[model samples]
Target chain A: MSADSPAGTHPDPTLTSLDIGHPVYAALLDPDTAFWALVDKTRVADTLAGGPLRDAYRQHADACRRELHALRFELKPSGVYLNPTERCNLNCRYCYLPESQRRSGGHMSVDQLLASLSRLRDYFRSIMPEGGRPRAIFHGAEPLMNRDAVFAAIDAFAGDFIFGLQTNGTLLDDGAVSFLTARNVSIGLSLDGPSAGITDATRHTWSSRSVHNRVLAAMNRLRGYGSWSVITTCTTENLPYLTAMVELFHAREVPTCMLNAVRCTLAGARDVKPDDGAMSRAFFAALDRTHELYRDGGRKLVVANFANILIAILAPTARRLMCDISPCGAGRAFFALAADGNLYPCSEFIGLPRFKGGHLLADGGIEAALTSDAFRSVIGRNVDAFSPCDQCVIRHFCGSPCPAEAHEMNGGMTSTGVFCAFYREQVNYALRLIADGKADDYLWDGWDDGTETLIDLAH
Target chain B: MTQTVLTKPQTQRASSPSPAVAPAIAVRKTCNPDGVGLSHYVLMDKKVAR
Candidate 1:
């Protein structure tokens, strides 16, 4: 971050790339402790024997080494997840929330919710050096379940905080859409697949209604309106239909989509999780097909998971994803606020009691929570600290693995996550995409990921 | 400049423009903190090797 030369501002035009007739290969590298450099090596070696080109290459290489020698991980959290209620309407089999919290029917009153938000505001103001306006996400269980508190939070902080909502999409009515869109709140909807058979197999509603049909209706209402996206969780049953799902997203006019693997939890729905190779291959097909479909069109389509991975590999410092990054945003970049003013690393860490940082309403809460043993353990983790990861060729690209997921599946954060194989496949596929000259399709530069890291596609 | 020309078995996949021309190659040796070799690799062609 302290680099004297900013990205995309290299003075010499020839420094960015060699004009060799052959195709140039580029990758980020940390050469040695002696050189003390971090470089996006374009690999224009001195094969010219003796010439002006060879001298120019060496000059550019030396300049590259001197320009960027260090990287800073400044955690500027983009959003805070507020769970007004811990109760969801539908019982999705793959839902990772502990069954107890799901059934507890715990809801925070409007007063308590406001108090927690105010305290959080004070805490954030004290910490954020750059002065950022972080968004508030209505998340956990079903945020819409207690609509009153959700509205109150927005009303109170609309001037100070941006707003977004993550919902199952079945409950979106015209009134809700109108209100949310009016305020420019980003809406994130969830659907398992394109059709009912794929979705209803696991997402069971109490009223026995079809989940896919309800969500599709909402999508129809949401099209060409507010800032909205869809998240379709991929499980064992829906692996074969990955391409179809992305196509449906494009067809339905959903601007962005993310495919997530079913999380491995202590409760165990292991059978539903797809194998890494299967998921990766299926995901590749989806991405390739979507690229062709959306390329020439007036509209744009973004596959969120693919884009996040690209950002991680291509622009590591500018990564905005909560998961996947080493020492993932959990206790670092963001935190999840439970209904009763409790602070968890993230919504996914809600059910696990051991991972609770502290209650936000407590005195000296922000400092206490951040300094907790669990929080320290999570925040201090890096790829170089562990095995298999330390030796892994793509450790930097992979960010090691999701520690919370690893702990849930393997009983220790040090052990790799259950989805490590699938994740590895994703990293390798991203590299292949870069090699094939198709990486720009998913390299998103729009996110305010708390870094000035510019995406330099010059080479 | 020295241009080394060589030939090898062809793959079923599409070939580059000049397969007969021996590709420019570089062997990058990675050393761990202790200066021990981790692996042996000499990259020939980026497009094919990747």
Candidate 2:
């Protein structure tokens, strides 16, 4: 079939050979005609089938393939989520951490910490062509529970690596703030919202103490310290307060906020997981409010959802991180180093044996574990191989089929999760923004006035 | 400036005229998964919106 052929016409042999499905074919068949011009199928096929444009397309495809492979092998981790201790002060209802693991007080010894950092440094230096500077992110049931280990790791690797900490914020005392600020360690505080009624409902201490005042006080104290970001996990309980959450962050002058949909996991409590439709509505509603704040309210609250959409739409080629890519970056660009010296592909795989790569002390250590068949299997699973997502027009842009979410929702790695609809809506919203010439409105930073130009809205 | 709440349905608008320079092919860079330093990747020159 030719490019001009109507729907249901015999499939283009070239596209059929390339395994291009109907949805992608329909996107290409758009009346814009520029789609074909950009793809230059005749050129691509001729190049593939041995013709004049062969070398150029071959070279481009080869480069993309090589980069993809390197992402799995050579690219050093941009950040490592180090679970310094499994101990947490709060028992969040929506937390996915297994109860057993949460009770255990396992902490990484200084020796173990040194060994892990050494392994990461060697791996990063060997694979990174431009000398990768990986950051050490301290995560936990509560990282602050083992503050000494965190400080030790920071002191040990301070000059060589950047440091970040994710905490409940209630434990962030004045001394903690001083230490973190002195070392320039960025902190991400887990806060549901500003109201004690909303935040204390789920995020409370083990003794059932209300943590709202403590957390808010910490937020106030850390305002001028290094960098501060808020991570709010959206559950049905806090769904009604989503807008309020953004407003609170803006009011605090928080630089960045990540509103994450709580992943439904078998190992965690059965708190309500919002349906795709509900999440889509809540996400867009929050996004609209955030945009209003930035464009009119003069608040610099940068919601990661809107920022990610903008990046996906405006700089598709520049998205090198796994979280934004097809196969999901789980094992490729990011990994989770458990406290017990075991390595997992992502944070969600901490307690799960099936996803364990190996130990940090293995002969080849991180490198051997990452290149192992187990890790490769996780990284190799791409959106192109998964259903629905395989035919998605926004597959290249929307970070879908997250390996951890897939396992949590579908009990497997290759399946798309409940968030597919929400992701599709987000991409659609981003496309609309580009088409409306309001792409600049999505710019949070990094560009001077009038520097960014919207080239085209592809989808 | 008053904050205008977005209540209208978000629909695809007509495509604008293409830029004189076609979008450049971006080789993905290693980025922080948390998006802390992502602004550095934002293009200052011509950029594709698609």
Candidate 3:
């Protein structure tokens, strides 16, 4: 068999690039060794001629094919980010939602929300009979703005799904806390940092009131309620305070913190977006602080990004269903149900007409919406279809550069210019952490063996 | 469940299926104990010691 030949008739889309600096990486790059020995097994004619090594390689390839087939077909939608209302009380400068959409004051009617939930329940039942509970995350400009609607949907779907809320936290008064606590709903508070200087710089209400104190107070009020996490949008303004932010979350005993890079959207203000180099530096620094808090400070703070990357390295299937991965799991495994009852591939694609999957009508339901051209277009974008991604070493586990980010930055899904460097840097960092054996320090060790089973099925 | 077949793009490399198992290799070097590796985690493909 020739060295250049593929190992199978169809190239496995799940092939990931190893950390090049790692010894395993060098071995794979060499064509002669068993490290990349499977590469030559693609020569079907030669394999049929019968060698023990070739037979073993062929057996492994067949297993991979079967696993890939199941991943592409049988994976069900894990959760839905349901927008209860597009209207947010806080008018943050870096808000990604189109101003028009945010200003529309649209709220998902209780009937509409219930209908969507019913449809989702039916779909889940059809796909996974024993999958147990599905999840619905109530999100919006401020999901708390339509508190009644959020509660109604929660009460209606409480038995059928696990409930979660992502709120600006300014609206979480005693009443809101009691309501959330009663339902045992997991809540994610958006607080840029602990200090007023950091938080008030960007996050504020429409009336120009600084929401820093209110959000902090809310965090304090809801401390003991269900699971609580923090989501901070990393912008230029908050870059310097990243370590301080992690410290704040750790101090507050917040278990998880998600430092999401400010995505460059058409509606995003230019001044708010941090430069790529600066963002990368700040992110790494914050990650270091997080590790220190865990290792030295003995804090149980989990940085979601690093934790997710650890999961990706140890478990491939966990990465597969994530939205960042190639052939993004957006429209397929997960989607955003907008306030207007319109289905979007994800929250990022909510206002974009090109990505509108279908409407969750009262009578017609969500099945037809799943098959819409918009939905199909997103679900159809496999890693093999992407240009540089097909050749990318980290293609399998790198989340394949967000397609939404690609479209926003370069006007199409084919170009990954916006997040390519950022992803590469972060992925390499995660790989380094794993190589150094410090990954477990920052990660929650409670991950079930289900991920391992999934990886075995696929890779 | 109806399987949505993912169409392989024409630009994809004509190769064999990806190896299902991770390659076996020993750890050559560990990063600094102080976690200094975090700061230098940027892509270092060319500088890799063979």
Inter-residue clash pairs, candidate 3: A6-A42, A6-B15, A6-B16, A7-A42, A7-B16, A8-B16, A8-B17, A17-A393, A325-A399
The candidate 3 chain A region of ten consecutive residues with least summed lDDT is A27-36
**lDDT to native, each model:** 0.61, 0.60, 0.61
Identify the superior model by DockQ, candidate 1 or candidate 2: 2
Please write out the lDDT profile of model 3 over residues A233-293, one tens digit for every residue: 8888899999999988888777777787766655464568787788889988988988887
On DockQ, who's better, 2 or 3?
Answer: 2
Candidate 2 stretches greater than 4 Å from native: A1-76, A267-270, A447-459, B1-50
Clashing pairs in 2: A47-A54, A458-B50
Q: Which lDDT tens digits does candidate 2 get at residues B1-50? A: 12222222223323569422222111122222232222111111111111
lDDT of 2 by residue, A87-173 (tens): 788888877677677776677777777778877776666665464466667887788888887888788877666677888898899
What is the lDDT for A363 in model 1?
Answer: 76
Model 2 chain A: weakest 10-residue lDDT segment is A29-38
Please state every model's RMSD to the true fold in angstroms: 10.7, 9.3, 11.5
